[model samples]
Target chain A: MTDSFSGQEKSNAWSIKRRLTILYVVSAFGILLISTVFLYWVLTTRLAKEDGQFLAAKINLLREILAEAPNNKEVLQEEVEWETAPFRLAKYYARILDSRGRVLIETGKMDTVAPSYIFPRPARLGQTPSHAAMRKSTNGHSLLVMTALARVGDSRGQTRILQLALDISHEDELISDYRSRLLLVLLAGILLSAGVGVFVAGRGLKPIEKITRTVQHISAHQLHRRLGQSDWPLELNELAGAFDGMLDRLEDSFNRLTQFSADLAHELRTPINNLIGETEVALSRERVVEDYREVLESSLEEYSRLSHVIESLLFLARAESSEARIEKKLFDPRKEIEDVIEFYEAMAEERGVTVTYRKASAAAGSGFVNADPTFFRQALSNLISNALRYTRQGGKIEIGVEWGTDGGLNISVADNGMGIEPEHLGRIFDRFYRADSSRSENKPGSGLGLAIVKSIMQLHHGSASVKSEPGKGTKVTLSFPD
Target chain B: MRILIVEDESKAAAYLKKGLSENGFVVDTSSEGDGGLALMEKNEYALVILDVMLPGRDGWDILSEIRRRGIATPVLFLTAKDSVQDRVKGLDLGADDYLVKPFAFSELLARVRTVLRRGPVRQPDILNIADLEIDLLRHRAARQGTKLDLTPKEFSLLALLARRCGEVVSRALIADQVWGMNFDSDTNVVDVAVRRLRRKVDDPFEKKLIQTVRGVGYMIEND
Candidate 1:
């Protein structure tokens, strides 16, 4: 009754729902983190590219002006210092160097912030002069610096080196502002995802928890409780169905055991009570030796009957038990049938009941069964005797071996006498079940004959069934698998 | 012949002693394992009936000890355990035979006789119970010098009862010995067979040789 786990028990630190939630959170966080980092990289790369193009445009403007007026240093300086908007994308610093790397013309603050030597090497002439590098100035200002070869003198004359710098401190502050905002969003996303993961996982596993609660409330006496098969999901429906199937088998076995015990006690109480009463009365006075002998003999007979019941019960138990090892060999069913018939021939002749054995002409195969010969004999013997008991004088009892429709061998014993009533036929194979108890009292049997027959059939992995018509006859057939 | 019974249950030991004594055996009973062993050491018995479950010095230990001392006395085990493993264990320990408890007295007696009659069976060609004679070799039965017509099964049945002439043979034993059916078939088949045999072997004469012992079994004797 203690429904303890049969194997090694596992001690888990976390519940299944918790584990599912953690798995969901970890995988989701991984995907979100990758995308967030990629977004930041794209934004920063775009801002840097724009700054480089802006520096290139400023270098091109210097190239155009110097080509028209070669010594106009003031004009180049004024062009570098001019700003149309009060709030620019970035502040620019430009310096023009001659062929000897001398500063011919420069912005006022260009030397202090750029210090000319910190610029990139000039590009080839007639090129776009793009691709600037970013550097931090000595005074803690962020700058984009670039150099290019520009034509000076008339229409692409001498080449001049133009160094330009863009102060990106304002852009850096804007990108930093975006980075912190993104961090806040990521943190919020993590918290939101974990919360949703917990909810979703709990919702998905709610059925399993319901099953556990139902199972926990079910003890031995509460076997009637069931996990209703309809409410479960598709995957768990199979599990629930199987569990209910097992419960059905268990309940059936439990009911049978209860009925069997009650019947056994009732059956045993009669003979035992008779023995006690018979002995007590016999010893009531100084009885004669003959009387005492008769009582003792009767008591021994009672004991023998009780002993037979016990033996039959044990045989039934052993056959049904998992450890019952039946030794099977390939043997002809005809031979065992012959032997059983021979044993019953005397009884048959005594009753004037004609018993016949036949092998149906339509039967196929060699008619040999791979089964325990003793059990076969016992099964045939019980069936034959039962047939003989039911048959009247001048009646016919026929036994035959034939191939059933499904290819299994069928051994049936049919009699032409008073048949059983239909209402009593359903439980005919139950232990100690007699249709007409009053009539069976006159006859001799422990009423376990058919039960033993049924048990033996089960051990052979076969089945026993009965077909009877109230006034016609009863035919019991045993089917063995092919 | 002498026999020693070591059984802790007093009622079982007492009835066994009485039965064996009545059957003309010099029986000795012991309620303890050590006492039984001491008796076995002091007395030379033809057979020892030992119960496997005892108060002290289990029957197996006593048996092994006796065999260890090189004693060749036959030992028959009586126990409530009817499992095949237990039976094989008893035999493997050199016991002569085994019988489960709640056993019929006739079965125990028959087993005891068979155990005592070990080593080269004595098959008599002809058995005489007063005027009835059973020819074992020829498979024939005759009374008053007239041949009794019986089938082979009937002949074997008569022979079995004649061989164990005066002792009561149980119905289960008869069914097993004759039909090779080992279960206690709760039926009157044995009674019917015996009745048919009685018609052929006993009905014709004034004296009945095959006698039913009334709820026990059959025995062939001139009584």
Candidate 2:
């Protein structure tokens, strides 16, 4: 519908500018025609009525003079001749017709009589005058003729009709002049509207063209390119701002992913080298049975390390690429937390770290919420591992699960250990980033525990935050939205 | 003989230690560039295996440093970077050879031996085990002084086995030494080559020197 109305295709024939211009021209021309027709009808009818009255009065005067001098034909002719100049100056043609409708007295150079004209009978005797008005031509000239009957001096038997006409050539020329002026005004309006329409169309399309140019210049390698804020409208500024923010996130994420892959390969190279190198060395040596056993045992340990690294790296890869499918199900938060803490009790016992778990009574309407059990367990395990690694030999670790006032569940893992510094807290979840580089050797980690934990929490649509000081204990909290 | 290993990782260092120690070469390692240059300047090493990336500097820098210091130690780069540009760059920087990581240790050992063979040791190019003899210089093989007709691949396989007598040479090592690049061939090229060489070198003999250890590769040993 819009396309048909706008004539979208044929710009040369009906552009938006031309269409708007045409509308203005057509409406103005129609209005001018109606007004000119109404004005011309009103003015021409009034002038004709007035001319008819003046002619009627003149006819009455000539009748009175003719009645006073009953047989004076030459004097009547002289009186009529004196009136002829005034009538002619007023563009009127007067002629006297006898009672039989024959032309008796003719004025000016009209030598032959014109054809008779007709009119409908009037309703009243004198209120609506019964007259015949028509266009007639005699010889080479044309004239309008109006005829009215008049009684000679109260004698109904003797009636005379006077015919009058006023030439309309000057009125026709005046109407033509008015029409030409109306056409000029209509043309001016059309041209002005057309120019305005083109200007508006250009202004409206400018921002759209800028968006196109910005998008065209972007590529995979150049994801950093963003639509910068410039001289744009309000909505366009907001759109460009949102686009730049999204690009900032994408570039940061892609760079981190690439760096992580490289680091994974670099980290795994060490273990694979140990496995292959150890096996080759043992097989190449001419050793006794006992020596062979020793070589086999050590090689098995190296293989296990390789397998462990590969498993952890695979988990990290799945998390990084978002390939890990999360199955959300309703599970009791209290039971899940207690079970996890109990499972880690044996490992904690070895280091004399007492692990205690406490679950607060489920809050109102908070018996359970939706969560991925596997990811939840994985995230909890990482927190436990970190707590145990940093805790003192006889320190206590608290694992508590509770329902928050808001529609969420909070699980906190707090331990009495050397807490992290404010500076390191932000980067603790980075791949291969350890709180203390020296502690890495002691704990013997792949350095992907916190990174994997962060990813798992993200998958579960939850968040993990940590609070720590230089010397006090640390608290790690996981919040799952209800 | 002296051998140099330029590896960035410590675990790989330990792995190479046991293998090269048993191969009769006193192996020394550098985990970075400065250490590797320091070791090369202080010692007269026969072979050097370097990695591309290190802490202080990279292997290419060590290679250039070694050359700048006029140390003509044969360096074989062992790294995970396997692009052509890396190879060309390493060779251009005075590296003797390049081997990508995730490599079979025996292949590494073989390259080390090959590089060392052309070094100062310059041992006799002829290898003899029991009655079987391989003349590396002439590229010929025979059993009990009887010259045998061997194909180009068979002669090389027989020669490699004869050189590493009494020790198990892995199939991956054999493939690497022969094919150069690590390509998986479906056919049992090693076994077929060994079988064909047995016909040429042991068929007309009274004693069989080419013996196969059940699950292991073929061995040329003394009776």
Shift of residue A54 alpha carbon in model 2, Å:
17
lDDT of 2 by residue, A401-475 (tens): 777556777788999888998998987887877788665543456677787788877877788889997777899
- Give the per-residue lDDT digits (tens) of candidate 1, residues A1-482: 33356323665558777887788778777877888889999999999888888887877787888787777766765686554123266777877888679987777767777898788777778786558888887688998888888887775356788888888999899989988988887788778878988999889998988887777787778788788789899988998998888888788778777888887998899789989999999989998999999999999888988888888888888787775767778777887888788788888989999888887874443676767888888888888888888889988889888887766788899998789999889878888888777775534777788999999989888899999997789999998776
Any idea what lDDT model 1 has? 0.84
In order, the Cα lDDT scores of the candidates are 0.84, 0.68
**Runs in model 2 lying further than 4 Å from the true structure:** A1-236, A280-284, A316-324, A359-365, A402-406, A441-443, B1-223
CA lDDT for candidate 2: 0.68
Best by DockQ: 1
TM-score of each: 0.80, 0.44
Give me the displacement of residue A335 in model 2, in angstroms: 1.5
Q: What DockQ does each candidate score versus the true complex, computed on alpha carbons?
A: 0.56, 0.01
Please give the distance, in angstroms, between residue A58's alpha carbon in candidate 1 and its true position after superposition.
Answer: 8.4
How many Å off is the CA of A445 in candidate 2? 3.5
How much is the lDDT of residue A90 in candidate 1? Answer: 75
